[model samples]
Each structure stands twice: as C-alpha cells, then as structure tokens.
Target: MASYELNAFDRRFQSISLVGAIEQVSPYTLNVGYWLRDPNQLILYPDLVASHPRLDFLWEKTCFEIFIGVQGEDYYREINLSPSQAWQAYQFEEYRYPETMPPQVAYDIELNQLKRTHYGLNVSLDLTEFMLAHKLKWSDLFIGLTAVLETSQAQQFYAMQHSGQNADFHNKRDWLHIF
Candidate 1:
C-alpha cells in the first residue's frame, strides 16, 4: 500500500487535510481510500443518490479523482467519484485531448464515514478490461490521486503534487505512484 498526503494548491485551506491511500488487491483490482479532515465542514458535499449512478461533471462540485497512465505514454484514463454516489471515467489520448473514450472497468464506491468534521470513501476498481484494451500490466502503470473541495467561497484543488502554475490535474508529471 502507498499513502500520500495531498497538497492543496490554495494555502488558505491549510486547516483541511486530504490523505489518499492506494493498494493493489490483485493483479487487476485496485483499492483506494480518501479521508478528508475538515473540522469546520468547510467543504460542500452532495447528497448521496440511492442508485449511485455514473455521471459526468462530478468535478464541478467536491469530488475525488484518479488518473491511470502507462509508463512513458501519453494516453491515460481518468476516473471521478462524488459523495453524491455519482461517478465518471474517461480515456484521454494526451493532455486532455481526444475529449473522451468510454472507460472499460467496473468500480464500487463505499462511504466509509461522513460527519461534520470528517469524510471518508473507499473505492474498488477492477481494471481487467482496461488493462487489456490498453495492452498494459500492473507494473506498467502509474496512478495519480486528486480531489476538488468546493466551499461557498471557492474551490480548492488537491493532488499528490502540483506541477503547473494552475492546479492542472491532467498533467502526467503529477502522477507519481508507480503501480
């Protein structure tokens, strides 16, 4: 398992801490967890939907994100998870180009805990089809973990590392976890 303390691009939200952990349960299964420690409930969370539907634009609100990329390759996959039980996944050719391609994988998100001071989520992703489609193996991939925290005031971005002047999560250089 690998643990990372995500850095917020905006220093004003230093009181809030976002931690991410990821592990490979099997050759094709990846488990990820995110814990947000916000004592003041400063972040906005969407109400959970019963269906846990897969939807787009979850990033417009507070949400978690994952980026999967092959070593030394420009093509990548992005997955988004929301507290609202909504999710989205997209395949990008490079640097957010080629808009999106249908993602090939199964995923499950469990709300581990939710409260005024803390929010937690666990995600399990099966990457069998995705790996096959991309001709990739577990050892050939890198993972990027990120999140967007939206409050009434503004939105803050969190990532393992930020390489650009702006919080650009799509930058492959920020994907530091080799899986």
Candidate 2:
C-alpha cells in the first residue's frame, strides 16, 4: 500500500487534511481508500457532508477521485468515489478529453465513518478488465489522486499538487507522480 497526504488549495481549510492510499490487491484488481482527517473536532459545524448511493456528479460535493493511466501514454481513466458509496468512471484518450471506448464499469463501494471525525471510502477496481478494455497491457502505471470538499460554509479542492490558481484537480500537474 502506498499512502498520500494532500493539502487544500486554499489555506482557510487548514484543519482538514486528505489522506489516501492505493493497494494493488492483484494483477486484475486495485483497492483505493480516501480518508478525510479533521483533528480540530469541528464535526458539528457546517454539517453539509453526507453519504448515499448516487450515480453521477459526485464531484459537486465532497468526493474522492482517482486518475490513472499507463506510463508514457496519453490514455487514462478518471474514477469518482464518493463517501456515499457512489462511483463514476470515465476514459480519456489524452489529457482531459473524453474517450468513448469501453463502457463504464460499476463496482461496489465501501464506506466507513470512523468516530464522526474521519471519513473512509474504499473501492476496488478490476484493473485487468480496464487494461484490456483500453488495450493497455504490461505497462507501468501513473496515477493522480484528488478530492472536492463542500461544507455548509465553504467548498474546497485538494490534490497532490495545485495545478493552477483556479484550483482544477483534473490537471495532470495536480496529480501525484507515478507510483
């Protein structure tokens, strides 16, 4: 398992930190977890967080995202995993452009809320299925992790690195280096 800690784009949300990890369970499977850490005990204020079994537009609220691709290639996939157990997957031919390739795959998502302070989201994807669907095999992988957080008082974006002043998580620069 490889872990990642993220800093918010803005400084006002300093009390919260986004922690996540990627686990290679098998050649065909990958497990991912995103944890929201709030040590300030600020759970009761701006109570806009939630979890539900939704299908789309999860990025509009507090959500975790994963962008993955084969090294030295433009092809990639964007995965959205929400705290509510909702998932969305999209393929891209290169950069931010969408690719109408293999159909989106739906997987069961697990949600664990620990002590009303930490939010844990877990989801495993069939990496082999995706690789075959995208014609990517036996290649080193590159990945990017990010999150969008919305509370009663504010909405914030966090990523491995800030890409621009506008706070876009999709930027390849915002993604962490290949692991």
Worst 10 residues of 2 by lDDT: 108-117
Q: lDDT per model, in order? A: 0.80, 0.66
* Candidate 1 per-residue C-alpha lDDT over 1-179 given as tens digits, one digit per residue, 9 for 90 to 100: 99999999986768689999989886778888898888777888888776656777788899999898888888788888887767777777678887544444334322222222235777877777777767788899999999998976789999999989999998988989996
Using all chains and alpha carbons, the TM-scores for the candidates as numbered come to 0.87, 0.76
User: Which candidate should be chosen as best, given TM-score against the real structure?
Assistant: 1
Cα lDDT tens digits, model 2, 1-179, are 88889778896778777887877665567777777776754322222344534366767777778888677777677787766556677766676665334434434222222112246567777666666665654347777888887755577788887868788765776666454
Q: How accurate locally is residue 128 in candidate 1, as Cα lDDT from 0 to 100?
A: 76
Query: Which candidate number would show the highest lDDT if scored against the true structure?
Result: 1
Residue 98 in candidate 2, Cα distance off native in Å: 3.6
Error of 2 at 13 (Å): 2.1
Clashing pairs in 2: 52-84
